[model samples]
Target: MVWGLTPLFVHQRILPVECWYPFDEKRKYVYETLYFIQILAQGQIGQVFGNGSGVYVVLITLICGQYDILFCSLKNVLYTAEINSGVSAELLRGKQLAVDKEKEELNQYFVSKETFENLDNLDQRLVKRNLRNATKDALNECIRHHQGIVKVCTLLEEFYNPFCLVKSLQMTVQLCFLVFVSVNTTASVLKSLNLAQYLFMTLCELFIFTYLGQVLKVQSLKTADALFRCDWYLLDLDIRKNLLIFLPIAIRPVQMTSAKFSGMDTQRLRAILTQAFSFFTLLQSLT
Candidate 1:
């Protein structure tokens, strides 16, 4: 709002935007009216940016939150399956301890009497079958969740990719001109401050998008890593086979892009700033 009224402090009549007008703007009443119009238009533009960017950030944040939840879900699926399948951890541990003890005792020409009782107490085959089925079911559920996330991403891409493309193009030009103008000329302190604020705002907006894009990409790719870090080796052969099939698909990273022309990441931000600098350098040389 303060930026929109910058003309008020200039001590001379001016409009927020300079453009060709059909009528004279220097007339006392005409100047006041046009000045009011320009300030109001600028204010409206500010409002759109404030509110629209909030919504944009929220949607992206929600998507990122979902990715986080999916990661936790994938990591815990096996443990959850074991719990749900009523697998007794105590019995498994007892059986393992018995087998180890028996091995040690046999080397000393002694067999422990408790080893036979421990081995007979556990229904190992039934436990294994139940765990396998539970794990398979859990994996299937996780796959469905993954599919849902993919669909949401597709929808987001379709709706926002074009907007991102336009925003990137607009900011590229705006940053280039802003840098050129700021460097090439002298201005009043207030004007310089205003330009700096505008430049900062533009950079901040771009940073948000690129940073979030990078975050989404990282979180999406980590899904596979999370799965791999789980106890897959202990899983049944059939369950491992299912995971082997799903691992490659999970390994593919999700990247947010601008109409498929460019990705929205730190690298993209670097490219944009580089392009803007090149323009600034060229304009400086020409002048």
Candidate 2:
């Protein structure tokens, strides 16, 4: 039952989908469908178990099942909200870039065509001053939009902390449960199955699934972080040039120190490296 529900929960929470319909309409459909399914499944499971005296157990199970569905729905809603917020940030960034580009193009057009060259000295100076003022105004507008993007990014980061904490806690609890079950199962089956073989198989399966989950979580977080970090404000020429020179050197020590502090746990270190490299590589590739 848990295994079946886990995938459904993850799918609902993590899968990105476009909702073209009205929000209330889509939400109503989701709520109705999930509730109906939950009712049907709980009835079937209880009937199959044939344990009528286990009314309290059945009620608890039903409640938990419904709670999980609700949790998944909430997660989906939050995910969509974050994406929409990030899209607003992207729009602001794009608008700022467009304004800057337009100003640059206008300045270049005037300069290359020598539109002010034929004018008297005073006239040329006046034209140049007007162009500068216009450029300044455009830059100010861009800055305003960029500030909006920054605020959205900060909010997204704050939102993600709670989500990541919840996911990590869920994973930890699941891991502990698996360990307890495996240990108890192995002990009970010692007479029928070889102890070494049973333990090895169980441990292998646990490690595989846990590692896969960690990988998925790391990838998702890295993608979201990269999206949030996508700001034109960091693309100043001086900063970009210096970042290239400093990044390799800066990242190496941080990676090494994190690994050492982690007691050389290769799995954990590899996960860290994956996230670090992903961010750095994204920054480098964005030019």
Candidate 3:
């Protein structure tokens, strides 16, 4: 039930084009940085390991580190949006003030003294009433816009919490697995020679690989979510300014799918599964 509903929520509503950032130089910076960090971490781990198992451990470490970076990037984008919204509100207020001044000035130029006083009093009252109404309307509009952004951010944050919980569980399971592997490896080494050195190596391998795998998984989700959200936001704001960039980013996923799940029914099921599995797999894999 949770699986079926979540995807419908995400794909049909939450995961729309309006939720992403515009694909531009800013986005490119984030993408490049995430890619570079992932690669560099992986490369370093690869160079440090000598055996196949040890190398695998390093690969996992790199993956986990990459995920950390992704989470951080998404967090940054959320913060940026919050800051931008505040700035936009201030700008709107300034524009309203300028408009009000022009309206007052135009009224002053057209009327004579005594007649103007009565007219002025009546006009002043009307202007005040209208200004109050306008201010309330503007405030409401800003609140609505800000509320939508906040809703998405809150949802993303909720999504992240489960990922963290899953990662912790996975780490605990991996540690137990490593201990079992280490005991077996130690027993074999003790029969032939001293076990201290081999035991240390086994422990190190277990820790590094387990940490790496967990981090990588976390980062992948983070990066993908950030990219998705950023593009959605940009597309929502001004499609014309960013449509060319947004369309490619938005449509790329649809293009990548095989024909098997291309039909409406299949696609619907796939989306449901995708959301359910995304939530489930992240948790299960960690466990």
Candidate 4:
């Protein structure tokens, strides 16, 4: 904003933006009128993009947070499996360790630890059953949360598709124009500074979108890893089966698209910059 209004303090008569005016702007009244009009237009455009992008960033951040929370839930589901039973994870781990040590000493233990514990009247089946049930419930909840995340992403893509598409389409041209103007020797120092600021702001806006999208994609892909690390092997057949079924779905990362054409990620920024540079070269060659 400060850059947009820097012309007011400069000695030379320069408008905030370089555009063809309908009337001659040399007259005092005409210059002042157009100056304020340009400032007003710039402010309005800034307000629209600022508010809209702020909301869009907030939503994406929230989804990333949800993914973080879901990961924690999955990793802890095994440790927290105490549904309808007094058996704690600490006790379960202790029992397993003791049985393992005893089997090593005997050197003739062929049966699984749980079976041996059951023979010892430790009620291992009851604990295993409770753990299995708790794991099943937690898996179901995680599946629901995953579904919700996918649904919200789909809705966001639909709602912001047009806005993102327009911004992406114009970014190359905007960058080229800003770069050309800022580097032009004939342009005033203040105007060049303003164009530089605008160029940085535009790049920052695009970075926010692509960076957030990358974060979302990376976090979503980590869900499968979280599931694997949650000790699924210790779970019963049904619970392990559930994890197997979910693994494939979780492996496929979520993505956001602009107008369902371009994927939103850091790569998009690179592609856009490449196109802008190519066009800028052509423009320079033409002149």
Instruction: Please list the residue runs of candidate 4 whose C-alpha ends up more than 4 Å from where it truly belongs after superposition.
Output: 18-31, 83-85, 88-129
Write candidate 1's Cα lDDT for 69-138 as tens digits.
6665676677657654766767545545655543442221111122222334344544454766788888
How many collisions per candidate? 0, 0, 21, 0
Error of 4 at 27 (Å): 4.9
What's model 4's overall lDDT?
Answer: 0.75
The TM-score that candidate 2 achieves is 0.25
lDDT of 4 by residue, 1-287 (tens): 77656776685587867788687886888888888888899899889989989998889888877887777667657655653244654576565566454544331111212132223443454445555676677788888998899899889889888888888877888998777766555766666777778889989998888787777788788788778767777888877888888889999988777788888888888988898888888877887
Number of the predicted model whose lDDT against the real structure is largest: 1
What is the C-alpha local distance difference test score of each model?
Answer: 0.77, 0.35, 0.37, 0.75
Write the residue-wise lDDT of candidate 2 on 70-115 in tens digits: 2222223322222323334444345435544334323211112211
- Model 3 earns a TM-score of 0.24
| Per-model TM-score versus the true fold | 0.81, 0.25, 0.24, 0.80
By TM-score, rank the candidates, best first. 1, 4, 2, 3
Better of 1 and 4 by lDDT: 1
Candidate 1 ranges beyond 4 A from true positions: 87-129
Alpha-carbon shift of residue 76 in model 4 (angstroms): 1.6
**Candidate 3 ranges beyond 4 A from true positions:** 1-193, 227-287
